[model samples]
Target: MNKRSLIYSGTLIFLFMVAFLIFTEQKKESPSGVVNISVQEAKGMVEKGDVFVLDVRTPDEFNSSHIKGATLIPVSNASGSNLSSNRLLEARIDEVPKKKILVYCRSGRRSVSASTMLVNAGYSEVYNMAGGINAWIDAGYPVVSSEDKETDGSQN
Candidate 1:
Protein backbone atom coordinates (compact mmCIF):
# COMPACT_ATOMS: atom_id res chain seq x y z
CA MET A 1 0.00 0.00 0.00
CA ASN A 2 1.15 3.57 -0.74
CA LYS A 3 2.28 5.68 2.28
CA ARG A 4 -0.54 8.29 1.84
CA SER A 5 -3.18 5.55 1.41
CA LEU A 6 -1.97 3.75 4.54
CA ILE A 7 -2.14 6.97 6.62
CA TYR A 8 -5.66 7.74 5.37
CA SER A 9 -6.88 4.21 6.22
CA GLY A 10 -5.35 4.43 9.72
CA THR A 11 -7.06 7.79 10.34
CA LEU A 12 -10.41 6.42 9.26
CA ILE A 13 -9.94 3.38 11.49
CA PHE A 14 -9.13 5.60 14.49
CA LEU A 15 -12.21 7.75 13.88
CA PHE A 16 -14.43 4.67 13.64
CA MET A 17 -13.04 3.28 16.91
CA VAL A 18 -13.62 6.59 18.68
CA ALA A 19 -17.19 6.73 17.39
CA PHE A 20 -17.88 3.16 18.53
CA LEU A 21 -16.51 3.85 21.99
CA ILE A 22 -18.63 6.97 22.36
CA PHE A 23 -21.80 5.15 21.33
CA THR A 24 -21.12 2.26 23.71
CA GLU A 25 -20.40 4.56 26.65
CA GLN A 26 -23.56 6.56 25.99
CA LYS A 27 -25.70 3.42 25.87
CA LYS A 28 -24.24 2.20 29.14
CA GLU A 29 -24.84 5.47 30.98
CA SER A 30 -28.31 6.05 29.54
CA PRO A 31 -31.19 5.27 31.87
CA SER A 32 -32.71 1.82 31.68
CA GLY A 33 -35.98 1.91 33.61
CA VAL A 34 -35.25 5.18 35.34
CA VAL A 35 -36.20 8.29 33.35
CA ASN A 36 -35.26 11.94 33.75
CA ILE A 37 -38.44 13.74 32.84
CA SER A 38 -39.52 17.38 32.49
CA VAL A 39 -41.73 19.22 34.97
CA GLN A 40 -44.81 18.88 32.74
CA GLU A 41 -44.14 15.21 32.24
CA ALA A 42 -43.82 14.74 35.97
CA LYS A 43 -47.07 16.61 36.60
CA GLY A 44 -48.79 14.32 34.16
CA MET A 45 -47.34 11.32 35.94
CA VAL A 46 -48.58 12.68 39.25
CA GLU A 47 -52.07 13.17 37.82
CA LYS A 48 -52.09 9.65 36.43
CA GLY A 49 -50.71 8.09 39.61
CA ASP A 50 -47.94 6.54 37.56
CA VAL A 51 -45.25 7.74 40.03
CA PHE A 52 -44.71 9.17 43.48
CA VAL A 53 -43.45 12.75 43.61
CA LEU A 54 -40.85 13.35 46.31
CA ASP A 55 -39.75 16.88 47.19
CA VAL A 56 -36.16 16.62 48.42
CA ARG A 57 -35.95 20.27 49.41
CA THR A 58 -35.71 21.38 53.03
CA PRO A 59 -38.89 21.27 55.12
CA ASP A 60 -39.04 25.05 55.28
CA GLU A 61 -38.72 25.37 51.53
CA PHE A 62 -41.22 22.60 50.98
CA ASN A 63 -43.72 24.11 53.37
CA SER A 64 -43.46 27.47 51.67
CA SER A 65 -44.44 26.07 48.28
CA HIS A 66 -44.41 22.60 46.78
CA ILE A 67 -46.12 20.46 44.20
CA LYS A 68 -49.48 19.43 45.50
CA GLY A 69 -49.47 15.89 46.94
CA ALA A 70 -45.67 15.76 46.95
CA THR A 71 -44.12 14.00 49.92
CA LEU A 72 -41.30 15.88 51.62
CA ILE A 73 -38.21 13.90 52.62
CA PRO A 74 -35.34 16.33 52.60
CA VAL A 75 -32.09 14.99 51.16
CA SER A 76 -30.20 16.18 54.20
CA ASN A 77 -32.78 14.60 56.47
CA ALA A 78 -32.55 11.27 54.64
CA SER A 79 -28.76 11.01 54.55
CA GLY A 80 -26.25 9.33 56.88
CA SER A 81 -27.54 8.46 60.37
CA ASN A 82 -31.13 9.31 59.44
CA LEU A 83 -31.35 6.64 56.72
CA SER A 84 -29.88 3.91 58.94
CA SER A 85 -33.39 2.80 59.87
CA ASN A 86 -36.84 2.93 58.25
CA ARG A 87 -38.58 4.34 61.29
CA LEU A 88 -38.11 8.03 60.58
CA LEU A 89 -38.40 7.76 56.82
CA GLU A 90 -41.50 5.65 57.14
CA ALA A 91 -43.20 8.37 59.18
CA ARG A 92 -42.43 10.97 56.52
CA ILE A 93 -42.83 8.79 53.46
CA ASP A 94 -45.42 6.44 54.84
CA GLU A 95 -46.69 5.27 51.47
CA VAL A 96 -43.48 5.33 49.43
CA PRO A 97 -43.14 1.94 47.81
CA LYS A 98 -40.35 0.10 46.06
CA LYS A 99 -42.02 1.03 42.81
CA LYS A 100 -41.59 4.41 41.08
CA ILE A 101 -40.34 7.45 43.01
CA LEU A 102 -40.13 10.85 41.22
CA VAL A 103 -37.73 13.12 43.12
CA TYR A 104 -37.07 16.89 42.86
CA CYS A 105 -35.60 19.85 44.76
CA ARG A 106 -35.10 23.63 44.39
CA SER A 107 -33.12 22.80 41.25
CA GLY A 108 -31.94 19.53 39.72
CA ARG A 109 -28.91 19.16 42.02
CA ARG A 110 -30.53 17.98 45.25
CA SER A 111 -32.95 15.77 43.37
CA VAL A 112 -30.08 13.98 41.64
CA SER A 113 -28.46 13.29 45.02
CA ALA A 114 -31.77 12.19 46.54
CA SER A 115 -32.46 9.83 43.63
CA THR A 116 -29.19 8.04 44.41
CA MET A 117 -30.24 7.73 48.02
CA LEU A 118 -33.60 6.26 47.04
CA VAL A 119 -31.91 3.75 44.75
CA ASN A 120 -29.50 2.80 47.53
CA ALA A 121 -32.51 2.25 49.79
CA GLY A 122 -33.65 -0.43 47.30
CA TYR A 123 -36.36 1.51 45.52
CA SER A 124 -36.47 0.04 42.04
CA GLU A 125 -38.06 2.75 39.87
CA VAL A 126 -36.46 6.15 40.46
CA TYR A 127 -37.18 9.22 38.32
CA ASN A 128 -35.35 12.53 38.74
CA MET A 129 -37.24 15.68 37.78
CA ALA A 130 -34.86 17.49 35.41
CA GLY A 131 -35.77 20.82 36.99
CA GLY A 132 -37.44 20.97 40.38
CA ILE A 133 -40.30 23.10 41.74
CA ASN A 134 -38.61 26.21 40.45
CA ALA A 135 -39.13 24.90 36.98
CA TRP A 136 -42.62 23.80 37.86
CA ILE A 137 -43.55 27.31 38.98
CA ASP A 138 -41.81 28.82 36.00
CA ALA A 139 -43.98 26.63 33.79
CA GLY A 140 -47.08 28.32 35.31
CA TYR A 141 -48.23 25.39 37.39
CA PRO A 142 -50.23 25.97 40.53
CA VAL A 143 -48.60 25.69 43.97
CA VAL A 144 -49.96 25.58 47.50
CA SER A 145 -48.29 27.89 49.96
CA SER A 146 -47.76 27.01 53.61
CA GLU A 147 -50.12 29.75 54.78
CA ASP A 148 -52.74 29.96 52.04
CA LYS A 149 -56.11 30.57 53.64
CA GLU A 150 -59.13 28.84 52.24
CA THR A 151 -62.79 29.87 52.40
CA ASP A 152 -63.02 27.76 55.55
CA GLY A 153 -60.30 29.98 57.07
CA SER A 154 -58.12 26.89 57.39
CA GLN A 155 -54.51 27.09 56.27
CA ASN A 156 -53.64 24.73 53.47
Candidate 2:
Protein backbone atom coordinates (compact mmCIF):
# COMPACT_ATOMS: atom_id res chain seq x y z
CA MET A 1 0.00 0.00 0.00
CA ASN A 2 1.10 3.64 -0.52
CA LYS A 3 2.49 5.57 2.51
CA ARG A 4 -0.74 7.67 2.83
CA SER A 5 -2.93 4.55 2.57
CA LEU A 6 -0.75 2.77 5.15
CA ILE A 7 -1.11 5.70 7.56
CA TYR A 8 -4.91 5.75 7.13
CA SER A 9 -5.12 1.98 7.66
CA GLY A 10 -2.98 2.21 10.83
CA THR A 11 -5.17 4.99 12.24
CA LEU A 12 -8.34 3.03 11.51
CA ILE A 13 -6.83 -0.06 13.17
CA PHE A 14 -5.87 2.00 16.24
CA LEU A 15 -9.37 3.43 16.51
CA PHE A 16 -10.90 -0.03 16.21
CA MET A 17 -8.62 -1.39 18.90
CA VAL A 18 -9.50 1.50 21.22
CA ALA A 19 -13.21 0.92 20.74
CA PHE A 20 -12.79 -2.80 21.41
CA LEU A 21 -10.91 -2.14 24.65
CA ILE A 22 -13.56 0.33 25.82
CA PHE A 23 -16.39 -2.13 25.14
CA THR A 24 -14.49 -4.95 26.89
CA GLU A 25 -13.86 -2.84 29.97
CA GLN A 26 -17.54 -1.85 30.13
CA LYS A 27 -18.61 -5.50 29.98
CA LYS A 28 -16.22 -6.38 32.82
CA GLU A 29 -17.58 -3.55 34.96
CA SER A 30 -21.20 -4.47 34.21
CA PRO A 31 -21.13 -7.33 36.68
CA SER A 32 -20.26 -5.11 39.64
CA GLY A 33 -21.44 -6.51 42.99
CA VAL A 34 -23.56 -3.41 43.63
CA VAL A 35 -27.14 -3.94 42.51
CA ASN A 36 -29.21 -0.90 41.53
CA ILE A 37 -32.99 -1.09 41.87
CA SER A 38 -35.77 1.28 40.94
CA VAL A 39 -38.24 2.71 43.46
CA GLN A 40 -40.84 0.13 42.47
CA GLU A 41 -38.41 -2.75 42.87
CA ALA A 42 -37.34 -1.46 46.27
CA LYS A 43 -40.94 -1.27 47.40
CA GLY A 44 -41.54 -4.79 46.16
CA MET A 45 -38.48 -6.01 48.05
CA VAL A 46 -39.83 -4.42 51.22
CA GLU A 47 -43.14 -6.16 50.73
CA LYS A 48 -41.44 -9.49 50.03
CA GLY A 49 -39.93 -9.66 53.50
CA ASP A 50 -36.32 -10.75 54.22
CA VAL A 51 -34.74 -7.66 52.63
CA PHE A 52 -32.74 -5.29 54.86
CA VAL A 53 -33.51 -1.65 54.12
CA LEU A 54 -30.96 1.02 55.05
CA ASP A 55 -31.57 4.76 54.77
CA VAL A 56 -28.25 6.59 54.23
CA ARG A 57 -29.48 10.16 54.72
CA THR A 58 -28.68 12.62 57.48
CA PRO A 59 -30.33 12.32 60.91
CA ASP A 60 -32.47 15.41 60.34
CA GLU A 61 -33.60 14.21 56.93
CA PHE A 62 -34.16 10.69 58.19
CA ASN A 63 -36.16 11.95 61.16
CA SER A 64 -38.34 14.05 58.89
CA SER A 65 -39.47 11.03 56.86
CA HIS A 66 -38.25 7.53 56.01
CA ILE A 67 -39.19 4.05 54.92
CA LYS A 68 -41.20 2.13 57.46
CA GLY A 69 -38.83 -0.71 58.29
CA ALA A 70 -35.52 0.78 57.15
CA THR A 71 -32.63 1.15 59.55
CA LEU A 72 -30.96 4.56 59.38
CA ILE A 73 -27.21 4.17 58.84
CA PRO A 74 -26.58 7.63 57.32
CA VAL A 75 -23.63 7.29 54.93
CA SER A 76 -22.22 10.61 56.12
CA ASN A 77 -22.23 9.34 59.69
CA ALA A 78 -20.70 5.96 58.89
CA SER A 79 -17.63 7.21 56.98
CA GLY A 80 -15.77 8.06 60.25
CA SER A 81 -15.99 11.79 59.58
CA ASN A 82 -19.35 12.64 61.10
CA LEU A 83 -20.29 10.11 63.76
CA SER A 84 -18.09 8.04 66.04
CA SER A 85 -17.57 4.64 64.40
CA ASN A 86 -21.32 4.02 63.65
CA ARG A 87 -21.93 1.73 66.59
CA LEU A 88 -25.65 1.80 65.97
CA LEU A 89 -25.25 0.78 62.35
CA GLU A 90 -22.83 -1.99 63.29
CA ALA A 91 -25.19 -3.22 65.97
CA ARG A 92 -28.16 -3.27 63.59
CA ILE A 93 -26.22 -5.18 60.97
CA ASP A 94 -25.10 -7.69 63.60
CA GLU A 95 -28.62 -8.11 64.92
CA VAL A 96 -30.18 -8.66 61.53
CA PRO A 97 -29.27 -11.92 59.80
CA LYS A 98 -27.42 -11.82 56.50
CA LYS A 99 -29.91 -10.88 53.77
CA LYS A 100 -30.42 -8.70 50.73
CA ILE A 101 -29.83 -5.07 51.75
CA LEU A 102 -31.57 -2.16 49.99
CA VAL A 103 -29.90 1.22 50.62
CA TYR A 104 -31.20 4.73 49.85
CA CYS A 105 -30.55 8.44 50.43
CA ARG A 106 -32.15 11.80 49.52
CA SER A 107 -30.96 10.99 46.03
CA GLY A 108 -29.42 7.84 44.53
CA ARG A 109 -25.81 9.02 44.68
CA ARG A 110 -25.09 8.36 48.34
CA SER A 111 -26.88 5.02 48.21
CA VAL A 112 -24.51 3.85 45.49
CA SER A 113 -21.49 4.70 47.65
CA ALA A 114 -23.12 3.24 50.76
CA SER A 115 -23.93 0.03 48.88
CA THR A 116 -20.29 -0.36 47.88
CA MET A 117 -19.25 0.16 51.50
CA LEU A 118 -21.74 -2.44 52.73
CA VAL A 119 -20.56 -4.97 50.15
CA ASN A 120 -16.97 -4.35 51.16
CA ALA A 121 -17.97 -4.66 54.82
CA GLY A 122 -19.01 -8.30 54.12
CA TYR A 123 -22.69 -7.93 53.33
CA SER A 124 -23.24 -10.45 50.53
CA GLU A 125 -26.20 -8.78 48.81
CA VAL A 126 -26.28 -4.96 48.52
CA TYR A 127 -28.72 -2.95 46.41
CA ASN A 128 -28.81 0.82 45.86
CA MET A 129 -32.22 2.47 45.58
CA ALA A 130 -32.13 4.12 42.17
CA GLY A 131 -34.16 7.25 43.00
CA GLY A 132 -34.05 7.30 46.80
CA ILE A 133 -36.88 8.47 49.09
CA ASN A 134 -38.10 11.02 46.57
CA ALA A 135 -38.99 8.28 44.16
CA TRP A 136 -40.49 6.25 46.98
CA ILE A 137 -42.94 9.05 47.75
CA ASP A 138 -43.58 9.54 44.06
CA ALA A 139 -44.43 5.85 43.88
CA GLY A 140 -47.16 6.39 46.51
CA TYR A 141 -45.44 4.52 49.29
CA PRO A 142 -46.00 5.55 52.91
CA VAL A 143 -43.28 7.63 54.60
CA VAL A 144 -43.40 8.25 58.34
CA SER A 145 -42.29 11.71 59.46
CA SER A 146 -40.77 12.62 62.84
CA GLU A 147 -44.05 14.03 64.09
CA ASP A 148 -45.61 10.62 63.52
CA LYS A 149 -42.95 9.06 65.75
CA GLU A 150 -44.74 9.79 69.02
CA THR A 151 -47.91 8.12 67.79
CA ASP A 152 -46.13 5.31 65.94
CA GLY A 153 -43.74 4.27 68.72
CA SER A 154 -41.29 2.93 66.12
CA GLN A 155 -37.53 3.36 66.70
CA ASN A 156 -35.13 3.89 63.83
Report the CA-based lDDT of candidate 2 relative to the real structure. 0.73
Task: Give lDDT tens digits, candidate 1, residues 1-156.
Answer: 999999999999999999999875552222433456788878888889877778777666767787777777776653243443343343445357677788888778878776766666677778888877778778877777655421221222
lDDT of 2 by residue, 70-138 (tens): 777766663344565654454345644478888898768888877777777787778788888888877
Task: Name model 1 segments beyond 4 Å from true.
Answer: 1-34, 77-95, 147-156
Give the clashing pairs for model 1.
none
Q: Estimated TM-score per prediction? A: 0.62, 0.65
Q: Which stretches of candidate 2 lie over 4 Å from their true place?
A: 1-31, 77-82, 85-96, 147-156
